[model samples]
Target: MTALTERTEVRPSSPSARSPLGFAGLIVLLVLTTLFVIGLAVSFGSVRIPVGDVWAIVVNRMLPGVFDVWWSQARESIVVGSRLPRALTAATVGAALALSGAVAQLVTRNPLADPYLLGVSSGAGFGVVIVTVLGFGAGMLGVFTVPVAAFVGAMVPLFLSLAIGGRYPQPTAIILVGVALAQVFSALITFSLLVLADERQLGSVMHWLAGGFGDARWSTMIFPVSALATVGTAMLWSARRIDVLQTGDDGAAALGMNVPRFRIVHLLGVSLLAGAAVSVAGGIGFIGLLVPHLAGYVVGIRAARLLPVAALLGAVAMVGADTAARSISSSLEVPVGVVTALVGAPLFVWMLQRRYRRAER
Candidate 1:
């Protein structure tokens, strides 16, 4: 645990480093791009709304009596009632997952690591299945049951990993423990879905496991958005610590960091973000794996520079994927997770191959 002898830091390209002004410009571009993607997502549903009208509808809703009643009630309903919440939820969940992923990779020093590398997704799925199949939390928490169950379930893996890792927890120990727990939780979810879940519950369970913002509402956005704001701010505040930790345990110790304690706190934060995202979006994958790597490529891997870009890039990717999921077929909505997996798998391979090439050089 004291030695980082096995770990190798992933260096960023020199040319990718950002000046403050250039970084600000990049942030602006990504923010605008995310907004554009959200607008597209709002416009692409069953009844297509133009982008201009989408913004207009949003403005009217926010500042009532300001704009005339030009747009139809039905159009407003579609935008406000359905797509707006869904799109915003997608963005929030994306940002949460991406930020969680960044922190996970940073703490673990594993390039391929993701938010769910700690088993949070599996735990969340198991929780959802337990509630949906067994009706365990039906009356206890009301509409809040699933999310609360999910948050609790997600904590299971964290506690287990910590217990198994003992006092001086190392990145490798956490990864191995997480993988084991993830598999166990995944198996439980499968058994529950297959044996306990009835025909009626199957559709929703499958949709949720595959991940989509189909059920997203203004009400559902509360937890994830709040978690992202809190956890994201904490991560930004600890940017210097992240930079130190990235230099490995030896370097972190020299900088007076309590490496194990720092890792533990980071894991807890990751679980919260991951749980919030999973509770709302239901096991959305690949954003965590893909976005940080993409963000690193653009911003040169400093946590300070990398985090915001990763978040915005994630939002853009998620909204774009959600839009595609909605627009793919007139008859059915595709799972946004499925879309992300389809894109993420190949892109990840390319990333791996690119890394190998760089290593060879």
Candidate 2:
């Protein structure tokens, strides 16, 4: 068979699936839900500020001297100083991860592809571990140490996969390579922490590896926000090209698109996004894997349609998970990754089963 004839096929969504009104409503609903979730997340930390007061404090801070300071200094500090940043960080990290997942799915043409699954998260964690072990505080590199390290680490697997898979590799080959690399990186992280880290450092690294937003602050938000804005926008701008690429390399080349160049740029974009999420949130899994699939159910499989919905859903899930982590234990905060894994694992299995059933039909 010719290259085009040998390509794997993907069925496009039916005309019934295209509904602009429904898409708009979904966006509006998700936006409102995101705001509500952020408010709820800010309201229910250990101190327990009211939801109404949380928004008021936010407005007061933004428009200072407008709303009277009815809330105490302590309450204001908790709302604006601590909880708000954490909540927003979760939202931003979630969106970045989801976008990365959507892009991974598109490029690999694999529903199972995700940053976490492909070892990108493990690589990022390894980078963070290296910095921590070396005692390389943010002094020299400033706030960029973790993010830079993470992006570098993330690119390793992506680059390796591209090289191993060749100019036009199969999806299964890329997935296997990613899975193997992920396992190797994860083992390295464990070995390094066990061998090099002190007691306090070990505990800290372990918590971060488990993933939570506790360490989040206004300063830490820069990497994720900027990454999401820049890379995410670029991906959306190239959505039609992504749609073309989905038809396989031969089809894309026939359309006069540069297939290899497109994949390289977008895959690097995906790495940057995943690295940003891991830099701030620390090895949170499933946001990337789960959110895109969930969004596709509502918005269909087009990149342009999937990206926005996935981002919003991811933001909601992360913020909601963080809130649950805090509320789940009065004495100790649960890791946000644990909550996502618990929810995601079951959903993933169901999705797999649903796919099988459809195939059998």
Candidate 3:
């Protein structure tokens, strides 16, 4: 079927979904909820800290000019040194992934268009593998190199997917191409580990591939957060255009909107956000695939409504998932990706069956 026809299938009939007043209220609640979740996450670690102290530590950090430092060095070290950064990074990456996923699904006019579904994760993984195998840099510079390479790597699948789908937004064909690309990258990642990486390196490589926030530092939050802020703002500002596009390209052009220009810009924005998220967090999947669908139950399919809500929901899910990953076992910490997969897989299956059943009915 034509891209236009396919887009028409999910056309937004719930125009009220973008109601400013209603969403403003929801946004306030979500923002507060997200803060609470962050605090909760900070309170739990290998050594549990009180929630009250967690907030106090955050307060001191935020208003150092005002609040006197009273907390012990160890307490300060635990909070500022590790937990806070991981918690903050989790929120940023989750929001970026979910927002990108929401836009991706809209851009492709497909229900399942996500960074992982479209090979962006594999591509990012490929980048990480390249850096790890090549010994690109060392010390501080080396730490930075992986993220840079991963961002570049993430773009590979997006561009390839576009090229493969070539002058057409055939969602089915594009998805298939993306899957194939992902497999190629996944195999290459394994090969790199087997041939290049040593025994001691294997464990870290595996964790990075699966996704974890263990190495997070306050410095880690900088790049992905900046990318998310810029691209996310662009997306929110273009919400009306996205709504127009949902009715398909013809509708957008008839309304004097630049459909092609919008799609090109839109793809770039998604790539930047999704790519940065993958680079920072490794291959944490399903926030993109799952969060938008859940948020859609409240916000409808419009970009304006879905984007922000999905972001908040995604933050909550990721923070919670990360918490579980680290907390569940003192001896063997689970990968955050595995945690998300456990939750996302069943939900994804249910969504597919429900969508098809609804379509049939």
Candidate 4:
């Protein structure tokens, strides 16, 4: 466990292993793969839509309402009205979470850094449970209720973390607080689940905690997708700063960045992104924790290159997970969170073993 917090010296001085054009090409390829995965996800469900008709419906919807398409309204409704938005939501949540995780790792300088690691997801989940326990339920805020509560809950921890850590993540103070909050919130959620939710509500609440896209809607998807776009664009621009940030506070300050202020601001931005995602999706874990490591392996730790790769990987992983969750069992759909955990846990174990092997060498 101590290995999780051990600071690693990023190999920034190594000669660039990738050319700009090559990196751009790789990113484009990954983006295409992500799109393909989303398409694949959209093509299957309780009522499967043919791949060709899926595109036609999407095209007709994208164009003016007058555009003619041969597809049946039910098929069009299934794709346009149901699965497309869900797939888009999955993609957006994946990208935002992976982006937030990467940023969290760089800022905290901890290999275990993730949206949940900082209590953001737990906070947001607690918010949802609170609303649910009160009977405010899903429609309380209309479409915005859960997400709004989630974003608000998520921000509280970020603020408290900064206050406790004095806006610095060094020496593990923030980590400790985050862990404490995570435990506290987990307890609260469990209590709410056991005491507050009825048997009929149990499945929904559990699915929410375990993470599912079954209830995804375009209205609920818009805010997080907007946050991802805005914050993701800012993240791309801040790549150089991110590199500087990984160099330690004194080093970054020496290089003309305001260490304290920068940490606070970046934490706020990432919390917003993570919070929005958590609000829409439930306590989906590990995509954020695991994708950044995979991205770093593909493109070095430099944020510019890492962000896109992470986003693509995250998007594909999420959509793929969602697709599998729905299709794997005829009797019941697995939660997307469970799929991610099943995938990520083994990867995490492998990474730990590889880390130890490197240490022995």
Residue ranges of candidate 1 with Cα displaced over 4 Å: 1-6, 12-21, 139-142
lDDT of 4 by residue, 1-361 (tens): 0123566666563335353557868878888898788888899877887877787778777785655667787887788889999999999999998988888778767777786665787888788776767566667677787778777877777678767866554636665676677777778888888888888666666767788888799888887888988987898788789888877878999999988678666766777788888888887889888899888766778877787788889899898888888998988989998989998999988987887899899
Candidate lDDT (C-alpha), each:
0.83, 0.80, 0.80, 0.79
TM-score, every prediction = 0.93, 0.89, 0.89, 0.91
Give one digit per residue, the lDDT tens place, for model 2 in 156-274. Answer: 77667667755454445545666688888889988988888899878877887889988788998988999999999999889889888877788899999987677767766887788
Q: For residue 22, what is the lDDT in candidate 1?
A: 86
Q: What TM-score should be assigned to candidate 1?
A: 0.93
lDDT of 1 by residue, 229-309 (tens): 898889988977888887778888998999988987897798889888988888888899889999887788888888888
User: Top model by lDDT, which number?
Assistant: 1
Q: Give every collision pair in model 2.
A: none
RMSD of each: 2.9, 4.0, 3.4, 2.7
Candidate 4: pairs in clash: none
The candidate, 3 or 4, that scores higher on lDDT is 3
Q: What is the lDDT of residue 2 in candidate 2?
A: 6
- The candidate maximizing TM-score is 1
